[model samples]
Target: MRLFILGLGYSAGHFVRKFGGAFSHVAGTVRDPAKRNDLAGIEVHAFSGSRPGDATLERISEADVLLVSIPPGNGGDPAIAAFADVLAERRRKIIYLSTIGVYGDHGGAWVDESTPPQAAFERTRLRLAAEQAWTNNGSGHVAILRLAGIYGPGRNALVTLRAGTARRIVKPGQVFNRIHADDIASAIMAAILHGRGGTWNVCDDEPAPPQDVIAYAAQLMGVAPPPEEAFETAEMSAMARSFYASSARVSNAKLKCEFGVTLAYPTYREALDALWRAGEGR
Candidate 1:
């Protein structure tokens, strides 16, 4: 099997690292050609503008599976806009990475794949649109993975604490779901093996407070926890504060039941503890 990735970013990079060997040929697109050094074994091509070049189009035609990790811009999904015709004709399996933010605020309630998306933010609205675009373009060959906040090695609260930029922001009754990068890779692999096409929520079992995660990381690192700041009183950027608007516990029952996925790190505590033991937060 051959795989083509539109964006070889952090989470997608982990997927490639874990599953690239399974595919006989693996290729990906990067915004900068210089990042090819970072992609290692995969064949890399430049794709910054809306449309991909002839070389990329050729690769797309030859691919059996396509993973789109690229975010949509104001103009909509770049990949869809550029390659809708090509994708419509290929009949290849597609997996679009989306966010749980598309569910909007549920007042700390549980939201599953069955819940209709009520996107409040422009970013999330674009994600919902992108999911629809890929589903429409791929016909019945698309699987949309609505992921929670992604955290893993080199990109976790541990890294933030070590950098001295960690903040223990407290918002009462607020909780968020998170998924480890490795689990995301496993989910993608499972989806490929199962060959099921639909929407699925990919996240951990726990819905935790933002401050608790930081505190856990600090304890694991044997450092004093950052000062607590109330969300309402804290000085934060519009983008950062916007995150506090949504408070929902995303469910992964569908991922486990449908895709038969068993997460490597089912909660932040397990992930942070493992990262700490590996000398990550030194």
Candidate 2:
């Protein structure tokens, strides 16, 4: 199979590293190909979410599978905005990586794909619109993976704590679901192989407090965790504070049942333990 990815960011990059060998041809787009020295041994093209080059468009047309990891912007979905006509001609499998934040603040309650998306937040509202844009315009099989907090490798709590940047912000009764990057890759592969169109919540089995993850990471590293700060009084950016607005324990039962995916790390504990063993913070 031939694979083309749009907005090859963290999770999508991991997916390529883990599963790029599965495809006969693997190519992807980055905002600036010249800056991505790490993306060696693969085709990398430049797409700033506006006008795509002719070569990139040709490859996109030939791809059997396309993975979109870009979020919607002020002009709406970038891929659709740029290549709607080109993409409209072909039939292929599409996997869209979305966030569980679309469920919004659920009062720490469990939510599934059937729950109506809470469009209270503008970010999530755009995400919902982008989801429909892909589904309605792709002219192919589309699987939307509603992901949770994504962390892995150099981006985990272990590294953040060692850098003296880990925060233990305490919000009473707030819990969030997270997914390891490896598991997300697995889900993307599963959805591609399943050859079906649907939406699935891709997250770990555990819904944990943010502070708990940091404390556990510190414990694993045998170091002191950052002091806790109450959410109300904590210093945070508007973007960081916006994340705390949603508190849903997103369910992944459908993903498990349909994709037959068994996450390598079912919770933050296992992920942290494994990362520690691999010398993440050292």
Candidate 3:
């Protein structure tokens, strides 16, 4: 099956690296022509100006399955809306990557697909609306995967800590669920191959304290862990601090039971250790 991906950022990069050539054909869209080189060998199209070009619509028509890892637009994707009718007519399978942040500030409780999204923050509320809009409006089945925090090789807590800036921020027991980028790719592939129309939480089994993760990464780097910043005292941007304020652990049971998939790195400790061993400290 041909898989067309919109957006070539972190998650999209993982998807492309893992499944680019495996499919009958692969195509990707980049908002900037400068990034067209990044999607080399696969079919690349530049979406310039304020809107999508005709070529993008044509690519959507050709795809059997479409994966959208782009950030939720202010009012859902205009690009997707541009071809929604054609996409529905083609009956394409869609995988829209969302975030567990939609279930905002659960106070460290476990959440499942049935959990109503609290969305304490505007960004998450927007994402929730985007997910619903695509699923309800499209004729094709939309598999919404509410992903947890994503980390990998150069883009993880290990690297952040090793950059001589690991802060043991204590929120007095706030917890987080994270998934390895490779595992995120695996989960998406599993959904494409085995899942039906539904929503699932994609996260590693272990939920951990942020401070503990920071300490472990510092130990691996052989450096004194960065200063402890109390969550209230840490100088944070409005957006950054707001995200940290959302404190909860997500449940991955639905992902495992529904997709029959297993995470290669089931815990942050294991995943971070592996990353450090790979010389991620650069």
Give the candidate number with the greatest TM-score: 2
TM-score to true structure, per model: 0.98, 0.98, 0.94
Model 1 alpha-carbon miss at residue 97, Å: 0.4
Sorted on lDDT, highest at the top, how do the candidates line up?
2, 1, 3
In candidate 1, which residue ranges exceed 4 Å CA deviation?
none
**For each candidate, C-alpha RMSD in Å?**
1.0, 0.8, 1.7
Candidate 2 CA-lDDT value: 0.92
lDDT of 2 by residue, 1-282 (tens): 999999889999999999999999999999988888878767999999878899999999999999999999977988899989878888999999998888988899889999999998788889999999999998789999999989999999999999998999999999989999999999999999996799999999999999999999988888888899999999999999988888988999999999999999999999999999999998
Instruction: For candidate 1, give the lDDT.
Output: 0.89
Q: Write the per-residue lDDT of candidate 1 for residues 175-275, one digit (tens) a residue.
A: 98899999999998887777669989999999999999999998888899999999989999999999999999998998998788998899999999898
True-vs-predicted CA distance for residue 152, candidate 3, Å:
0.5
True lDDT of residue 204, candidate 3: 92
Candidate 3 lDDT at 53 equals: 67
Compared with the true structure, what per-residue lDDT tens digits does model 3 show for residues 1-282? 988887767887788798776789888777776645556667877753255667777787888888887776676665466556667677777888999888888788877888888867778778888888778765677899989988896788777865665577788769888889999998888878864678999999888888888888878877778778888888878877787777778888988887888888999878877887788975
- After superposing candidate 2 on the true structure, give the runs of residues whose Cα lies further than 4 Å from its correct spot: none
